[model samples]
Target: MTDSSAAPLRGGAVGIVTATLAVAAHGMAGGGWADGSALALLIVVSIGIGAMTALPERSTVLLLPALMAGQLLAHIALSLGAAEMHNHSLLPSTAMIAFHAAASVIAGLMIAAAERLYGPITSIVRAVLALLTPLPDGSAVGRVSMSVAVPSVDGTALDWVISRRGPPVSVY
Candidate 1:
């Protein structure tokens, strides 16, 4: 995709992916499902992060930190919105932290790899499609058909021709 056209898509994809991974990681770490308000907050924060990430040129290095930061922010939002909480502290337990970190790294790597491969994959798909498209019939290749207007003549002149194996033949 061209840089200009790709920005919005990349931004949206990054935001959504980060937010989703954050929620999933929280659940996997036994954080339970986030409430509606928390989910809303996560979405907003993720969008902001995504917009920021999209401004720069495409790079896996830049995206990694943005994803990680977005995940962390989302986790905080989730923690704050919970009605009943297990951990009273500001930070989660070491195990939970580790889980989120691992999830972020894995997800970030996969997303980055996909971004890298997207250009090549699209080109290949286009090439295949071009090859698959039907061509004009062979019989129509040499066929000639046309009309012309003669202003000098009182009636409109008709000029047409047909092509066969021998030579050009005027039909009118």
Candidate 2:
């Protein structure tokens, strides 16, 4: 069975890269890359959450930690650079790093919850579309006509264990 979650995972990765580039561009233009790095980390975390919603639940476990690590690394680099350039103390930088890491982890958990619900949400949408579609006989559809793929082993595996096509219902 072809994994349906692949598309969302790829999309999320792309989104992260795009957001990072956008942050870099803004930092360069404003000459505040170091100061803006905190904001950039937050933005990246938010974007990652949005993308993770479309991914499979199991993937979130790995992805979230990876994202957090990336954010941590970025935060450290930015903090050190800013401290060196401005000859500032490390106390404030340490505090900011802690905040960013905590925030990123919280965002990851939210994304995981969203990802867990994605399949059911998509199923409901498909069901609604089936009901809304008009029939030649002027009857409303009762069920999804397409083959529904059920994810196996919790939300981690997208292996289609059952493929069932509902009764044929004509739609105009």
Clashes of each: 0, 0
Predicted structure 1: lDDT: 0.74
- Predicted model with the maximum TM-score: 1
Per-residue lDDT for 37-99 in model 1, tens only? 888888888888889877746555677788878888888888877747636454776766887
Lowest summed lDDT across 10 adjacent residues in model 2 is found at: 22-31
Error of 2 at 158 (Å): 55
**Residue 147 in candidate 2 has what lDDT?**
81
lDDT at 39, model 1: 82
lDDT of each: 0.74, 0.52
Q: Write the per-residue lDDT of candidate 2 for residues 1-172, one digit (tens) a residue.
A: 2235654754475346434633353244332455555556546554664465445453554655665555555544444555445443433355444554555566556555655666788889989988998556645578547887776557557546456778899897
Work out the TM-score per prediction.
Answer: 0.69, 0.45
